[model samples]
Target: MVTLGLVFAGPCLVAQQAMGAGTDEVLQAQLTQIAAQHHGKVAMFAEQLNTGKTVGLDPDKPVQTASVIKLTILFEAMEQVRAGKAHWDEPIVLKPGDAVSGSGVLMFMDAPMTLTLKDALTLMVILSDNTATNLMIDRFGVDAVNQRIAWMGLKDTHLYKKIMKPATEPMPADQPKFGLGKTTPREMAKVMERIGRCELAAPGEPALPGDAAICSVALHMLRNQFYRDTIPRYLETLDSTEEGSGIASKTGSLNAVRNDVAIVAGKSGPMILSIFTYDNQDHSWTVDNEGEVTIARLAKAIVERWSPAGIDGKTLVPGLGLAPVAGGGIGASK
Candidate 1:
């Protein structure tokens, strides 16, 4: 790993070397500007697959992942299938008891219904569906998910059970608290890299019955994510004529946080990026609209800045960074 000097200093200086030479100054400047503009702690990580190079701002700082942690749930579910503890095609009943009050279309359904484990997983990842996630988590067992997190060697990531309903207020001591997921930008990127490399399967582990076929199935499910419907809409300003170098991405948000992570097909190879912003004050449903637009804009700007023609190797400092002007629109209210 190459070390980069910080052109601008402060708390952002921690882990500065993780970004490599010449890039640290650029990232520090970007983070300083973002922190000033948004009045929030913003951490980001981007890795170039072709070169094994990474650039980040507060890369290891732990923050709320919001719905982005669903990706972990998605991966763990796939791993369970690989271990023969569950089946992708197994039927799961959508009873009222399974409902969770947060994001997703599944929460609006009236009658109890049935869906395959595979379809539920799709809805969970593609739509960031909370109801689907809760049902799956209940079935898979929250303890199992945490076990997988430990098994995967993620230090600052974990699920604190599952949130079933929107909080009217903080809960009492004995009542079940609404458990949300938390992680740092760097840890999230590691999980994405693992998925891209098809390394979700534990090594030296025997393939359980019916598990061998799951690898392709898991890949297919990820490839067919429903969020694709919103990417073009969000990234409309991007030069789409450059065919075949598309991106696979997921966006997550809460009241004050906005985030997006993607694996971009670059000219040299795939590039992975995870950008997270927290404590954003632009919460208006009308002024800021959906936070997704802002998040997408950030993503586009990072890609443009980091790519060959984007920054010209010059560092982006305070008052000197590119901003994403447009992209896919934000999702409707959760």
Candidate 2:
């Protein structure tokens, strides 16, 4: 890797490199180059669900969330369902005013279309439906979402407002800096990790508080996501005939920002990858946008270097991390 008198090594990596054990030179170098290829800022965080091996490039740096913030809304809804405060089958009415266009079928539908919270959640992810996303924010209040995030102990993750709407209340000073919402890649990766573990619960492994069923529903919806232009772009299994290997991911994009958070099933186990790019010079919404392609290539590289074979439709144990590392820090650049 091109170490400019300093390297962007995370805690586990730096410690391993010290013991002459970790630091996959070739992989790290490739990852560094991938970040450089983007004409904007990039941040990434990945963890081996089984071994807990991690990789980070500016993972802790806060960045624009775009539609990725919708994940928070989804999560809060899941928690509410678990707490009996909400139901997936609960009906949500879509009025004429709810139609705020960008990405979704709501605008095309007639006024007062009805949909269950479950179905709306699915559309919000699969289609990046701005209208459904706004409906969700209204049903699940913005304050509740922020409170849930705080209760989850995620300081850097915050939802600023509903999509395409003015903020109802005062927001933090940084809200303008990160559009719609804000979160660090590392924090988001941790959230994805929890989702992966929750979905991978073994039989008779006493159900956790959140309920594995909730996790299963969310994962299934993510797997059906319509946007494959980012992380899953260059993958081979996507072209397969059978529903063998599965990938549960949520992708977010703006004209100048692209982000994807996913739990990719691997032969060994699931890998959680959260990557974000902002201030991109290329703002095209095309499938082959440079930023989108960069994320896809980076994802391919991580999977190839870490989980290279077949999944065989088997679930592997979740490995948190091999060993504790020294200090962990994020790398920053102008």
Task: Residues 1-334, candidate 1: write the lDDT tens digits.
Answer: 5555443344232334364553535644554454434434466787766566566767787777777787788778878776678888899889977777767888798758999998888788767888898887878866677688888888887776566545444543423321377777888888776666556557776445544345445434443345432222343334332221145556677676777676654444456778787766656543343444544554555555555443211111111122221222222122
Where is model 1 more than 4 Å wrong at Cα? 1-17, 21-36, 165-179, 203-216, 219-245, 286-294, 305-334
Poorest lDDT segment (10 consecutive residues) of candidate 1: 311-320
lDDT scores for all predictions? 0.60, 0.73
For candidate 2, write residues 175-214 as lDDT tens digits: 8788888998978886777666663333455565657568
Model 2, residue 172: distance off in Å is 1.5
Candidate with maximal lDDT: 2
CA shift of 241, model 2, Å: 9.1
User: Distance from true position, residue 198, model 1, in Å?
Assistant: 0.3
